[model samples]
Target: MKGRTVVLDHIQGREAAALMVDGILEDFLIASDAPPIGTIYRARADRPVKGQGGMFLTTPDGPAFLRQVKGLAPGVQLLVQVTGFAEPGKALPVTNRILFKSRYAIVTPDAPGLNISRSIRDEDERDRLLEIAHDQMQGCDYGLILRSCCHGADDADIAEDVSAMRAQAEQVMLDPGTEPETLCDGDAPHVLAWRDWTDPAEVATAAGSFETHGVLDALDVASGIVEPLPAGASLFIQPTRALVAVDVNTGSDTSLAAGTKANFACAKALPRALRVRGLGGQITLDLAPMPKKDRKGFESALRSAFKTDLDETILAGWTPLGHFELQRKRGRVPLAEVLK
Candidate 1:
């Protein structure tokens, strides 16, 4: 872990990991891939349950449980977004208005009764349901997590996740069967690890160039670098195994960002993270060895670069060997499309 580092810190009966780079705290991850719940599904209407709760909508799987009016107003159709599970290991029949709770999610054959279940009810609550679905689709662009990655996230982040779910659902509605039975190819463990980056704060604050400082630039740099390569590079990228190696050599003559040149150099390197799209692992950087006085600026620059993916980046101070340690987030293999 040269440029990125992650240290586990236990807080309040739970374990919270602090991501740092060159000794700066960036992001934190509580749980990994918990499950997708409350995702909307376009389901066929099952007979309404007179009492107890709502109807059991027929999803791609089988009957999905729905609540009639949990979060709806009285006299309204009580259109609640779909929630609950169907039978496990059941392939859902693809049909019109088959079964879906909202715009965010669809009931997949995988893990129906388990987590990642989908279903939405409440006709009047369509607005809310639509909102969630829309968010789910655009969540990655907006730095929001999918419901599968939503556990222990704060309210604001959770809201982003809900939105991602909705957005994804809407896309399904607009064009059916864009993908096969599965929406996404099963992502690798590293992809889930990388998704832990992206600070909600960075998404909120900072505009334009400045706003791009945090996860945005990092992701941008990583993606840019990794996607465009001559075929058969023989380099395989993986969170559990793959990592990027960066070596910073101080120019013989100091002509770059004066005063805190070391820090400035680190700033310049920020975009490289995104260009390469490296996540959930270590990146080692050997900073151009500078005099003791130039150290402060170098430290500041390193800290600032992490704000983009602050949620998952870790910075540990220079090591005795004079190398900087950084732990970045890694995700599933970059889609073949992105590589081109």
Candidate 2:
């Protein structure tokens, strides 16, 4: 397994971090603009908007909206997790279904169940993890979902992580009087990008001013420097409100075979670009035109590349116009906006 490196570069006039996996830019982190996701809070339901099918809650950080009321009346207290941050005028999005995440697993306090990660394809490992969850959760009243990182982890380590998460969940339940505010601050973007997006033996961190690293150069390329690619191909990424669009153009070489190779190369690089830029939500890839029979192979290659994404990503198949559609779970603001 290749070790992932986290480079914190303050040269951009802000606290920016990048996740480099096997020398490829996997993700970017900006500490200034976006509010951390997964922050837990205990809030009081302000009022129910019967028409909107949701209720507003008051929290220490600010107001949050619960998309579903769930029969809770005004003034009823509820424990919620910060799902999304506030937009220009929108309130933060919160959910009653709380999940406490640890280094190896996620603990769901509102439900009691066990779910292995879909990324864990090995039946034996999945079964073993399930057994561990059952044994550890014997008397516990919370749910456990092993993260992808838990694959091949020792039983003792998994047990320890579960125990710690359960303790945190217990603390939250015991102290229901927590002021309507963020009870626990979420992990930093760098922490999340490393933990969720990469596989590494160890992670190292540094502070203060530092010299430019190769990751910085990758950032420059991603920001539109037209980095060189295989077979004289160049990639362009455009971020928009609706979705991120990627265009792959072959350099001067107008041969059909060259175009096909460039398109395939783009398939391999597009996922890394999306992750590196933290460009989540809808994504459309406009690759050079290829034969209809080759579409399946191209799509398969793209799917394999996206397997490393931290959040769930669905390839919605190619459109009639030959553009590929993809949807990724929205966890934070895009890095482009954050940098701006």
Candidate 3:
């Protein structure tokens, strides 16, 4: 309970994975009916939206939207990858930038380069990973990204991962399919747990591990609106149709620094709260009554909190009404929707 632990289990008869750190739920992933991100598809261009610079494509799952389109003739078949989950009644988000990602390596077909992960800073380790990349990706034109998980990983395993990713990229990129098709299925939740949770931790695979490790209990709290914060502070995360509203309050704390304390706690706890709940899109934070001078510190705290999150979150700065705002990518389906 004091260390990092990963639970590969099922929730509501659906495959799910949870990462717990120091007995707290840090992240959660569950399979959903929506097409998973990272799935590659041979999409056929349907029609472009006027004045939107976007084109709609046809996929096996459903209609997908590709943004920033230019001169894509109708019926043109091209490779695209699922970028994120779609909002209700919206086209599935797809991008032309395809990436073949694995635990240790990511192969980029259009981008040609070999780069080591910036986290692996040891020169010797960097050199070793570079050597592995150079050897495995020899004569390959595709770009390779050595992930942070490559640090301290076996050379053979890293080489194998790189090779497999490169091979998959080649096979998928070279396919001559003239019609819409599903080229590659995305990695599932359990596989994602193994792939992304690279930190040293005890993996629990037995049945009902979620309950044994208190993951189910944590999830119950995550699904609710109120998220308890430090020092008797609290934040309510309510997902409305337009945006996620986070309201912070100092509960029965009659101290002079109560507002600052609650605001800081909200800043630190916001990312994990949204992540565990799989909430995304527009986010507006109504912090406790704090001085204007403390805005910079609050912004810094929020940035530091989301620095390591996998989702794409843009700290869109404060609004005219003193509320903090952000735009987060819909990387996963909302937890409530998934569970339902």
TM-score per prediction, in order, is 0.33, 0.81, 0.98
Writing each residue's lDDT as its tens digit, candidate 1 over 134-174 gives 54443232222133333333445545545544465446545
Q: Taking the tens digit of each residue's C-alpha lDDT, what string does model 3 give over 1-340?
A: 7999999999888999999999999999999988889999999999999999999999999999999999899899999999899999999999999999999999999999999989889999999999999999999899999999898999999999999999999999999888899999999999999889999999999999999999989999998899999888899999999999999989999898899999998988888999999999999998889899998999999999999999999999988998999999999999989776
Q: Let me know the TM-score candidate 1 reaches against the reference structure.
A: 0.33
Cα misplacement distance, residue 36 of candidate 2 (Å): 0.8
Question: Residue-wise lDDT of candidate 2 within 84-186, one digit each (tens)?
Answer: 6555577888888888887787889877789999989999999999998888878987889998888988899999988888888888877857457567777
The 0-to-1 C-alpha lDDT of every candidate, in the order given, reads: 0.39, 0.75, 0.93
Candidate 2, residue 79: how far the Cα is off, in Å: 2.1
TM match of model 2 to true structure: 0.81
Q: What is the lDDT of residue 103 in candidate 1?
A: 20
Instruction: Identify the runs in model 2 with alpha carbons over 4 angstroms from their true place.
Output: 1-3, 8-17, 46-57, 68-75, 85-87, 114-138, 151-156, 208-213, 225-228
Query: Best to worst by lDDT, what's the order?
Result: 3, 2, 1
